[model samples]
Target chain A: MPVLHPEFWRLLSPEWVLVCFGTLFLLLSALPATRGAKRAIGVMALFGFAVVLVLCAQTLAALSPGMHVAALTGLDGQIGLTVDGFSQVFKFIFVLGALLTVLMSFKYLDVEKAWTGEYFTFLTFAVFGMMVMASGVDLLTLWVGLETMALSVYVLAAYMRRQEPSVEGATKYFLLGAFSSGLYLYGTSLIYGATGTVQLGAIRLALMDRLAHGGPAAVGFPLAAGLVILSVSLLFKAALVPFHWWTPDAYEGAATPITAFMSVAPKAAAFAMLLRIFVVGFLPLAPMWTGLLSLVAVLTMAWGNIAAMLQNNVKRMLAYSSIAHAGYALVGLVAAGRSQSNQGIAAVAFYLLVYAFMNLGAFGLVLYLQREGSAGDQMDDFDGLIQRSPLMAVLMIFFLLSLGGIPPMAGFLGKLMIFYSALDARLYLLVVVLAVTSVISLYYYFRVVYHMFLKEGAPNLPAPSAGRPLGWSLALCGVAVLAIGLYGQPFLHWASQAVLLGR
Target chain B: MTIGWILLSLMIALCALGVVLARSPISSAISLLIGFVGVAILYLALKAEFVAAVQILVYAGGILVLYLFGIMLTDNEALRLTRQTHLQAWPVFVLILVLFLAVGHKLYHSDYTPQQPDSLLMVTDQSQVQALQDRLAQEAAAARHATNPQRVARVLYGDYLYPFEAASVLLLVAVLGAVFLAKKEV
Candidate 1:
């Protein structure tokens, strides 16, 4: 028999809404129409995305109430899709971020005349990949989801082949991404060999038994942990410090909207996998890895923040900031791995939610400040931006400060929660390093403010270009940043109580 | 089955060599398809016929053809495959060699091989066969009411039908996508 639950059907078929709207987009894009129809399609996409967000919120609510929504109701052995509390939270973030990105793409699309059918098709398809990645139950599902997302992003990144930089960035990303995925698969194969299971819950059960009986001397257990960690593919997606060479190029080259989407979505999805693998599967080996990840966390923060301080290009700075944020999230994962409380995991989710808003808002501002000469996305371009468009300048300042973890903004609350969770778990060194790095981040982040309000612009800026679409598209996200920052305790509590939808 | 396995292995090796040695995109694509088919054959040999069929249909028929057609449409000429810079080649090759050696050593030492199943059913020993036959006869007489021989088939087909349907749907979408991508613009 069927699961007999409406919510189960909705959760299992989360991709339905996206696929439907995307097919509509593909068809409409193929047809000849004025720019009005194209813009309407973009609006329709945003509406469809809103539906996804609502569905995700409902799923989160159901999972938080500890409801058992059997994903594979009739399936004997294989697990289907489950929208657990954890997956629900990340899915909410992913869909919400993509919604904002699609909304922001409206202005860029209208401005660049690059609003083709392929653009929306790939974007919708990529968002589908992110949803799948966030909700995946097993290794094979996760791998397929990751590749689906990666292939779409590759095309999106190089969508403008006429632009030399775009082509270069896409080529480098594709080659390196393929290599890293191979390594990730190799690691997954090793873990499968050790555990004989691909499902996260099964892997956790197997690892717990191995650790319990064999203690520290269990060869297969530790090897499994290492392989599973490798299988998370953090180095490629999150751009862990050593594996971050592609970040600067890709971020600098892709269309502004694409860059914004890439920065938040893939990184957030990888963290989902990281949380599952570490907190659930490798909790037994926490002592060995927590210290190691703490060090990675510390170095990632220090290196990323310090590197940001030296970059004049806005995209490159944001790239480094993204790396720092990953470190921040990694700290939460490590604490969650070591602690009995779900606070750390909750903090990571909340941080991701807040990070998406701040990062996307900052990129949106970059899109706003764009002109013929400056084309935005440069520190110099923001010079005296308070004088040109005071509203956008203020918004830009808000985003940059939030990114720097300044108080009274979403980014500060995110950092506070993550650091507090770590401290609660007695991760003293990680907390201390995070504190120091937050201070370091302030220098580079303020440079944006310094350029916007402090420096004088060259007289040749050609006065912010016409036909710029500016309105409440990102206003919701901005309000989100403010509201979540001030009154975050409720979300935190709910996030902690959220359970996996799977059995 | 053994012959099939041997042939599949040979085909895979040949495809790998072709991938390395072929200069043109078409040849390389053909090699990829060949390798994909060989993998499907191996899957069939393992009694995973569904997976084998899907593998051939999806990877070989859909994805490889899409890639080949993409190459054909985008750049008709066979462009020169750029060689790696000589200065960097040695270091890269050495690194790859070291990696291969390390993996080889690990696989060599690891206790990962599955134990062979005992050949009790196939054994030619007269006493063992007679003993087995007597035990089977006694059990058969004791449990003469066995009525559900298709229990496993029922479970697999009836219970896990949705995911099976979903996989089919996913492949259908992929096919449509490849065609959409490969179709020439008017």
Candidate 2:
């Protein structure tokens, strides 16, 4: 018999916290008690996230010393839960985002009388899966974690099953998600055939070796096909031009809290994986993927901005804007392939962190403006927000400004970093395209600002019925956006450090 | 041995074509099973008996069963074949045909051919064993060498026993999840 080591459990501690919290929440919901039981679960989840935050901090320090710890050494010698700079920064983002989204959900759920323990449990599970994906260095492990998160989100999107849009959104998301996973699996098979290894690190070494010898191995049938398939799968996740059919529907149709979570958490996590795999696993083929990324980035930004201009729905506008932000993030990804990989990656990390807060804050306001029974995301719902509630108007202005990349807001700084990184890579054409697209994007983002601040109050529109507690949550998100924008240097430094760690 | 391998490859290709050309989804799915069987046979011909067995068990049995269940649950509207309403269908088809031609032209010009390894399994004989032992000792001398035939056996036997058992546990979890998800709430 094999003797178990103490460190094995230590390494798996992060995953354990998520599982325990999820199970406990499930049990609490099943038994049920006072109103505070639901509130207590949220508090417990916050506490659990605090613990994970501390654990991740420790791991980050260990990783700073350039530690390379191989997991399951006795068995398969797998690479589990790597703690490089890439993962360290993303783990922070994932945990922080989950905590905030849950807080926002607390207010929204309580008001809707839909506060269920299973909801928090599923959120924890999905967050845990994202963490796993961030650290995954093997193809199979990454795929499994990705599907786990997708499955949970599918159910969460349709949490309000009686609502038609919720059900339709969930079904569409599931069908497309399953199809993407299939493409990913097919890619994995092709990669395995080309390299005879499923481990990312091993595959990199094999591919590097093949390229060194200028022979048949350098370019071949299955290798190109595999790379194309993998790009398609990642494209689906990133919601680039051709693969973005699901984003608007899924975002607009799901519950407000769930939509808020979807807009930030999963998108960031997906980009994290894409960065690792493309920048590390496929580093040898930078010349190939860089050009492809540039083209897609241009198309996505252009199309996403143009599409948002036509949308009358607030949620749909945010959805298209999210796609545009993805294009902006791809600029950083393209720069990662150039001479300054660290700068490009750092830019992406910073952009995602800012995006998580701004998007979530915008959605929080949507939740507040929602009528008692209807989905809280119609454009007309924001009519005369300045008259109905000056505070909400100010918050909405802050969010839209941040999203529009206006100066003195967090979104501006994020855009500054990405555009500068692309220019540093000497990508002249891409820089011009991104700049023009950002101008086009300004039109749509300001449209909401126009409606909220300038338009006259609707005579028939009722005042927002959400109490003081929910208002405070929105206020907090708004303050966070301003603070992060004004005092973003510290965060930017940390993100840059994380990028260096990936190198 | 080459002729046998060629014959098995032909069989697999034929079955794969059958999978694509079959009318009904059920028949197409069944043809895929036949293609999988042919792939397993090819694996055997290549002397990868372990991989061959796994291909049959996992792909042919487990995954195929999942697909069949999925098809069974899908409604007729989703399954129906309807004529295209979009005006761009013809253009899209033409584009695909042109793309196929480009790919076919590239493939026809290329000189690439499959280079089959002599055997997937190393022949076990006294001299062969001695030669393997010598290579193993040399590799053991240098720490850079990853694994040998013997160490793989030891680790799989010793340290991996729990995970092997845990895989079965996972299978159980999957079965329960499938049943629970399919059941209507009381």
Candidate 3:
């Protein structure tokens, strides 16, 4: 357990910044006149993210390189929280993702015919949860953060109260999410019983010392069981293969910007938490967990890619694609686990950053196509997209190609680093699976590209009247995807430096 | 005391069985209520007064009423419990068996020591009776009882302050979501 610095409270300003802004937004929603100003509230939420981003940047700046704080210790040496380079990097990602989502939601919410006030509130709270998740060092604190995020997302999915599928999807998500939380809590108890502590840092030290010298063999079975249950809970949150049943329903049922937000922000937070737990805490027992995660990565990719190939609904397809993306990220995680190097963590972080852009851009286009009284997310909706709006077609081309791992798009570079690390770790079988899945993925992705360019039909969809705000956000993501694709070395270096210490 | 625990456990198990076996929603809710009471009693036996009170107040008092209300509002006379075929039952049973074995194996093999309370065990060892009584008296005298409620509050407000604040924001989000979804026009 680490002793608190003199300015330990100041280290938490970014999260409290979110909490204050969320409270203000909550109050803003309580009043009818203010709440009905949908655009204003959404913009306010973006401002909150901007403030948090600035605070995170400042915290990142203040901390010297290699200044890694161990878990915050409280009364009786119970762990409270932590702040490190990895956490700061993830905080930046969460705030940026929230900012982008809010920017996209400004017009999209009104267009979807949903009330806007609580949407912003829930979204901000969800962001807060992500931030909490990034910084949490203890299992209970992490669980609190996870539930906060999950609960908010459940409500967001059912925001379309009048829609039947939306309600059903929300119900399914809530039930499964709650079940997973129970499993997570049970795992926490098991770990506590085994190690006599909930501080992940302490648990790691205990396990390492025990491994170095002889200690009680009494804890091995429960610890292994606990790790399995805990990782299953996280894998469920990340939408990995066997635990991804709720993805399509929730993504399709929720409003589009939310689907984009869900695909990136929460997923990144879960991965960050996983990296912290597995790499920092469970690295000593790599043989126990690495095998299971590798198998999960392979199955997730296969199922996600194959199922995606069969979907006609674009949102549902992207949901499946998101699962496959998580699989790719998992490969990075497993490789990171295998090696002493931080390359795989860096690669996973970079992949999530690029994924946030391309995935959001794709969903942004879906929002553009959506008109009142129609979903506009069907496969046929994309017919003659090039002829109708060449600009959207081109942007969609950038995102779809990126998703397909085409070169000169950021997604390719993301996959390159992950594959490099996997090869470095000698995970040749996973590499083979990755190659095959990418090929299978190309067929579905270009199927969208195929729809836009080749399948000429009556341009009978709503005129691509996506408003100026939505267009600007899409352009930002588009420019990011392009720029990162071209010159990603700086971002790559930053990601490499952002690995958790005390490994 | 051991007998008391056994009886409460029996009530809980039976009530859980009723909750699954009862066909009507009302009966299920009733069984769930009984199960909750048994849980509260079990908590009390462990000397976790705060948790026992909360188990009764929140789970039995609030959530059960909510459940009954939902059942009443969605009342359907024609509704019947669907029967599972042997194939469906077999797979589920196998899964449950696997889970049971896994947990049971850990419980059996691991050094899981049951925590004793401040009260005495009613053992039939005449040779150790005087020592046992003296130990119980010493424990009773040494008990500087800080109740669970006070300890929880102290932890929540002292060491875990930020998480508590974050939890408030979580509740705010929950409230906002409830209004957003449940209301026809938010």
Candidate 4:
């Protein structure tokens, strides 16, 4: 019998924190005594996220440079959960995203008349799930983590059950999510049948062994099909084009706070899983998937930017822009595959970090403008915002500029890194598509800016007031976006340290 | 044995078709129950007795009862009217058929034999081959004595303990979500 070491629990302290806080919040939400303590619950949830973030940072600090700690090991010496720079960095991003979302949700939920304790509970649980996804080393563990996150988001999406659009979007999301999960399971089974094991290290060894003996022919068709199916399911989660139909509706219908959360936290976790699975288990098949993903990256960039140009709804436009951003991130992934170097992965990590701040800030501004009985999502809603509220207009411009990759903003640094990595990998065509699509993306992002600064507000429109928590959240995002842009060495170095520890 | 297998597969396929094609919700549900039973029997034939039992208990017993309760509670007229239309059925069927055929062809042609120590030895010396045979026989004997539930328990509690616990967390999230969505007020 194999005895689990005590150190295993120590390494997983961050996840343990989330699980405890999540369950505690779930119980607290059910109690009658806490019925009116909505802000208190949100504050406590934010505190929990802070604690998890610190723990993740501590874990990162504790690891010696170039170290991977296997948190759980089976009898055969298979690692089930790993604590490394990569996982810790992603966990930090997840916790930060959740922290910001909770901070912003306190006032939005009250405004929408949808204050419920379960909102905080699900947020904690969802972050916990994302943490699990960041650390999980086995295929089954990742899938369970993914489902935990997806299920909570589904419920959160439909939290406003009285509204038709919320329920409609949730239903569509659930049906499609279930179908993709089925495909994932089927692909897992096929791969298991082909490789005779599901462990990432074992799968890599099996593929390499097969290739050495039988060349490409020896790997067989089942494994190839399995890889394709798995990639498709993951791509669906990341909201890349062709699998992004649910995104705009879900983003538009979900409460603005969740729209912010969904576009950042869960998407980051999905990218983490993508990098883990592809870079670790499927590295040998890079030649095949790189080509396929490059094509996807091109389609996603062109279609996402083009589609965003046509949207009048600000929420829907951001949805398309988020899709375009995912495309840009995929360029780094393709670069990683081609170069087989740490530079591309580091670029992706940095990009997601920058994206979480700027994208969430953009959505936070939307939440800031939202009033009772008016979603404030239409492009016209931002008209003459400079005349009404100079502070908000300026903040919106900063976020939009950062999102459009303007110089002296964090988003520009992110795009520069990705472009540099892609260029280093000699993916010239992908680089050109990325650059052109970015220019195209600026058109839509600037359209919002123009509405805010250049156009005139309606005479009857009232100036929007931001709640204390929402203001703090937006301030934090704005500061992070600019600070990371101006002084990004430490953050960039941190991202570079998070290298995928392959077998 | 071959004839029994073939007949069982045909019956299962026919029942699946019935479940999809039946217009009445009640009829479709009954077809689903029969289909579940067919799957359970298939598991039994494959010697996965624990899975067979689970297939019957979970799908045929628990889920089927839940379905019946749902059908009973909802308006029959509404259920009939809301029956899903299958406008793209033919195209989807063709796509699935093509995929199935490709997988079947690949599986049939693949070299699926378990790796043997003799293959690694290359020389195939007599004593080594004999030792390999002895070890294989012992393993087979041990496998024969172990019940299906024991094998499942070993895997679930041993190699996959972390994921098994994670799955419990997933279930808890699901329950919480269902309550949050269904409750009239929080």
Candidate 5:
């Protein structure tokens, strides 16, 4: 007999909504009227996200706080899907980010002549993939979810086929991505060979049993190697250094709003997967993993910051900044591993939530500035933006300052929490690296601001026009950034509640 | 039985070498087909009849043919005229040697060769036969449960229903994306 709680269906309802709409959007895309059908599909996709957001909120409301009890009724043991608070919160973030992506893409799609139903369809599918990644209870589910997300993004990256740069970007992304997935699969197989199980919970129990019997001698060198290899793949997805060669090209080649989507939602998903695998599956082997990851974190921070400083194209610069942010998130994970409680994990979740808003806002502004045919993606494109449209120019400065982690916005709060936790864990070297890179990152983000407010706008930029949709989209991002920055305790409280699911 | 294992392993190694050394794409594909056939034989020797059949049907028959077609159609074939491909050969051989030695060392140290159930059951003692029979029955039951489609479906839908369903959405989006990018003319 099945576990027959009516609320059980609620756990699946968000996914159900995405599937139904994704298929509907797919079929609708097959119709001849591309733009008309695409417009309706975009609105429906937005509605779908709103509905999933509501469902996710309801599910979170129903969960008893601080409980280690089962979240999903039947599926936890059957295939390893967690219906826990952690998954719910990140699903909420994914849905919100998708909604914002659709919102920001309205103008971009029109400008790029890509206002087709398949665009929204791919977005919906990728969002579903991210949701699966966050909630996956087993390695198989996470791997599938990661691939599903990657494959969709590959198509989305090349959505503009006529453009040479776009295709070039997509090709590099697809090739590197395939290679990385192979590494990830190899790591998974190695772990399976060593542990005799694929479920994270089972791996934990197996590792514990070995530890109780003979410690590292039983777990051995190979299992440790497998964990490190698996981490490289996860780190690759999050666009860490050494594995991050694909980020700038992919981000540059994709349409702007899609780039926005790529930067925020997928990175959050990858970080969730990373935190889950480590905190749940490999927590006992912290001694082995902590040192390895801390070293990686330092390299990622240095490369991301140093490379970002050298870039002239705004998109490539943001790509490197995104890599730096991953380094900061890694620092949080390293902290979570050290502290017995869930505070470190909570700090990471909160950081991602804040990162999503600031990064999306910055990218949305990039989209807003884009003119037809030619991408307004260079720093000079932003020269003297304060002269044509003060509201946008000021908002751009706000996003830039926030990204610089100035105390005025959510980005600072996000960085502060992560640093505090690293401090708590006595990760002094990582904290110092985090501090130095952050200071360096400020230089690059402020360069955008300096060009916008301080420098002169290019003479040939089309007169600034703010469509109602674009205005509302920027307003939403701007408000979230400020709200999370000021009176952020409420958001922080909810994020702390999410860390309970780290178990 | 030992002789058969050694002979099959040697055949597989030789076939694999033929695949790597072949000059043209067609010859290389044919050699790969032969290598796959050898692997199927090895699988059959291990008593994995289903895997052996699938290996022959899929790798040797299906994917190898597809590769041949792709090689014939595309310019700048992935396979080259030069044997300078020996660059990859050195690292791959070294890696495989390391892997084989490590696994062989572990197997030898663990006394795995002496533990064959057939050798144990060959004893004439009645108590030993009964114990061996019970153990074999349990192993068979576990294997049967593992191979059964219905049980697999239960595991797929029961535990993995969300990802399973999500994969359908992924494929749908993929279909839509391909059609939009290729079929819809600007």
Candidate 6:
């Protein structure tokens, strides 16, 4: 029988509400009467996100604290989605990222003369797609979710169609993205052929059964090939090294708000999918993948930090920085794989939360600088901002410090947790790589600070006017970075509880 | 039957090569269409009648027409003149060959088989031929009663309902994207 019962719908209410709001945004965008009320539409989108956030939070709260059970939704013998703390935490992160993206886009879009209701529409759908990625337990369901998010972002990346670089970046992103999707589907088919099922739970059971009866040799080569291919696609989406060629160009070419959005939301979603698939589905093959992932983690950190130091453009630098940050999070994953505890997973979750705040805050400052004709993403644009706007420069400093993992900032605590987890797992080499790259990262991050505080401002340029929405977003992010850094125990506890729920 | 399979595979492979090697976009598209038809025939031979029909209807009939129109409308002269380089193709081909060889060696050595009854029965001992025939007869009866479309629909709407619904949303996003990108005005 079909699992279209009331409980299924209730459990899936967040996705339903998101889809409804996304459709409403689409319809409103199409209507000429609503065309002029772009800000109102944006507010409505924010309101929609707020409603879904509340719904997700309520579901999370309703789950008894420390419960290790997942509320799955699907027909008998064919479970596809699981609602649990892990999925909810990631969903909350995606919504928060989208919320901040909308707030940052208000003035940026208006200044660029690129305000369109469809922008919010695509943003809403992208979050919906991400929510699906977080919750989906079936390979096909996750693949569909991945495609939905990718398609929307591809369009959003080229949203400023009039710009040549925007179109060029989106085109390159689309071609590579399509190739990766093909790889994912191929991997999924291979795994299904090997295991006789697409559901993660079923795949695990089948793998366990095979391992028990025939030993390691029974696991088969196809499964190994499938795992490697699947990880390549996920790594590509997360913008890890070797598969991260598109990150710098795409980040630089897309509109600033979108760069911020894609940097946090989609990357977090990709990690969520990675954890779900590898930890839950392929746990039996942990020894194989953990070794593979550690190598990837080390390379991602080395290359990402080294490349960021070479970039003069703030956006591209942040792009490479985001890649390095992904590397740090991968360390958490590798730790999770090595150790017999949930600390590594919790560290990853907490780090992504901290990342979303400081990274968005940094990008928000960049957005604040964007004006009618000036893109304002160059290091020269930030020259002596303290003389003009002390508060903005100070706020930029906090964000930069946090991103560099300096003490007494949320980013520091995030890195510390990952460090502690790696140490716990006895991954000495990964720990060293993480620490050294973080220190190397500080130099590039502080370069912006150097220009902001020490150098002289351009004689012709005026002080950047921060809009109310942008200011609010920056203030929230700044407060989060500081608050989470100072008092991170409760958040860490929450992350650990969420990670345990997956077990 | 094996000879027919080999011949059909050769035809499909040659058409695929034609798609890549042909200079003009029109010929390349035509080659792709022939390739699609060859795959549909292969599907038909596998008794996946619904899949074969849909492959022809969707891929060959609809998408190939769109491709033809796109080729017709765009500047094909520029497409034809642009030299398509295979700078990294040789390395990628070698890597793929290595992978293929590894997989082939594994397949030859291992006793891996799909967890399906028909395939299991096919690989059973000669003494179980009577039981296999009975099982095949029973399966034939069941297949006749359900029909291909009914079985497909049963699984699509029952077991795979979530992904099916999600796929619709995916297609909607694609539509919105196409219109948003291609439209003359916001």
Q: Spell out the clash pairs found in candidate 3.
A: none
Error of 3 at A184 (Å): 1.5
Clashes of 3: 0
- What tens digits encode model 6's per-residue C-alpha lDDT throughout A1-503? 32556656666788899999999989988877543587788889889988988887776776655442323532113457777778888888899899988889888878987778889989988988998898888899899999999999999999988898889888989999999999999899899989877877667657766766886678888887887889899999999998999999999999999999999999999999999888777766666678779989999999999999999999999999999999999999988876767888899999999999999999999999898887889999999899989999999999999999998999999999999999999999999999999999999999999999899997867889989999999999999999999999988886775553234
DockQ values, each candidate: 0.08, 0.10, 0.15, 0.25, 0.18, 0.24
Highest lDDT scorer: 6
Q: Model 4, A258-363: lDDT tens per residue? A: 9899999999999999888887777777777787789899999999999999999999999999999999999999898777568998999999999999999999
Model 2 Cα displacement at A479 (Å)? 2.1
True contacts kept of 6: 0.35
lDDT of 1 at A118: 63
Model 2 lDDT at residue A325: 90
Query: Which of candidates 1 and 4 reaches a greater TM-score?
Result: 4
The better candidate by DockQ, 3 or 4, is: 4
Tens-place lDDT digits, model 3, residues A129-151: 98788777678778888889988
A1-503 in candidate 5: lDDT tens per residue? 23345555666678778877887887887777857667887888888878888987877777776432454521224446677778878888888888888888888877766777878878888888888888786788888889889888888899888878788988998898888888888888888989876778667656766766774567765676677678888988899887899899989988888888898999999988988888877777676677768988999999999999999999999999999998998999999887766778888889888888888888878877788656778998888888878888888877877888898699999999999999999999999999999999988988888898789776766666656666788888899889889889999988886753435
Clashing pairs in 4: none
Candidate 1 lDDT, B11-72, residue by residue in tens: 89999899777878778888988899888878777666777878998999899988987887
iRMS of each prediction in angstroms?
A: 12.0, 9.8, 12.4, 8.2, 12.4, 9.0
Question: What is the docking quality class of candidate 3?
Answer: incorrect
Sorted into a CAPRI-style docking class, model 1 comes out as: incorrect
Show where candidate 5 strays beyond 4 Å.
Answer: A1-5, A66-76, A460-462, A500-502, B1-23, B31-48, B76-162, B173-180, B184-186
DockQ of 3: 0.15
- At residue A193, what lDDT does model 5 achieve? 85
By summed lDDT, the worst window of 10 consecutive residues in model 6 chain A runs over: A68-77
- Clashes in predicted model 5: 4
Provide the lDDT at B64 for model 6: 99
As for candidate 5, its interface RMSD to one decimal place is: 12.4
Runs off by more than 4 Å, candidate 6 = A1-3, A33-36, A64-79, A500-502, B1-14, B86-145
